[model samples]
Target: MPQTVKLRPYRLADEPAAVGLWQRSWQLAYPQIDFSQRLEWFREHWSGLQLDSRIVVAECETVPDHLAGFVAVSPRTGYLDQIVVAPEMQHRGIGKALIDAAKHLGREGLYLHVNKDNSRAIAFYRKSGFTIAGEDINRRSGAPVYMMTWRPAADLPPEP
Candidate 1:
């Protein structure tokens, strides 16, 4: 892992690398799924989904044009559509950094639907202060998923 990881807004130039990272991350997480086949679809919706959202990308200083990970969040609705981290970059705090950025952007709350079978992600979200509020099925994949959410703590009255 590199000593420095920087976060920035997603640019049109980062499209290919971002799309590639999305594929690689999903492939590593679920080898049974051929994510390469979905590259075109992902590319099509990558930026389209971020139209009213903030897409943040994390890059390693050690390697130029290296995409460590990225998170796409909609502050308007506090919905997090995607958070993908490079396989090699896992456990290096890049994922956490991306999530932190998401939290900052979606201040009202952060909501996301993660695959139910993805225990690693579920656990990570829990550790990051998100809770499983409900469940749903992915319309495209028909996979079971948990609707998780995180809201900043609010101050209570000093005395009731």
Candidate 2:
């Protein structure tokens, strides 16, 4: 069984761990991209989220300081800018926990753009109650992507 993980507000001190996790996770997903080259790229985006997003980190139950995963949601616009889980910690419910956290943060609705080729992530989002609402290209990499949105069950429209 997977160990329990506790979610908490992100602190300034968590930046290094959080960013490291971000890089490692992305590197595993898109190995062709050298994420290390984008450290400052991530820092710029992280700085923006730090100012306006509701950032939450999942802490390992037994290993207190070990960050298993994290999610960042813009409270004002409900955009799920980032959700990452450590490569070693994938599929242990950490990602789901982070999604649940983002759901609570974006009470009305949540929206995000996901890489089109990442079927694993796309399937995960679909299973999480998010539907593909549109399509677009990734601004940074110009890769094709899909727009996904999610709302609380109670807020969903009645079935036909």
Candidate 3:
């Protein structure tokens, strides 16, 4: 059985673990990419991340300080910028908990961009109630992607 997990605000001290998990998770998904360069790129840009971005990290009950997953959201627009779970921690509900935390921030809706080729992530978003709002190229990575949006179930239109 999976252990309980707690969601908490990101702290300065948690940066390394969070970045490490981000690096590893992306590495697994995009093995063809130059991860070392990507890791360094993140390290260089992480400090300049917008001050209004909200981040939540998941802590597992069995392993206290070790982070299992994290989600980042834009405070002003409720744009979900990133969500990554350690490969070993995937399918353990950590991602859902982090997303739930984002929803509790009082946003009526949330949106994000996901790589088009990442079928697992696309399926996960679909299961989480997100609908493909549009399709475009990710400016940063130059990859085709889909813009997905989700709203509270109660806010959705009634079924036909």
Encode model 1's per-residue lDDT on 62-106: one tens digit a residue.
788899999999989999999999898889999888988888888
The numbered model that scores best in lDDT is 2
| Candidate 1 wrong stretches, greater than 4 Å | 155-160
For model 2, how does the per-residue alpha-carbon lDDT over 37-121 read when each residue is reduced to its tens digit? Answer: 9999999999999999999999888887889989999989999999998888888888898898898888889999999999999
Model 3 spans > 4 angstroms off = 1-3, 155-160
In model 1, state the lDDT of residue 11.
Answer: 85
Q: TM-score for model 3?
A: 0.89
* Residue range with the least summed lDDT across 10 consecutive positions in model 1: 151-160
Provide C-alpha RMSD values for all models, in order. 4.5, 3.9, 4.3
Runs with alpha carbons beyond 4 Å of true place in candidate 2: 1-3, 155-160
The local distance difference test score of each candidate is 0.88, 0.91, 0.81
Tens-digit lDDT string for candidate 3 (42-125): 876666453767788888877878998888887678788878888888877777777777676526789999999999999999
* Model 1 accuracy (lDDT, Cα): 0.88
Residue 58 C-alpha lDDT in model 1: 95
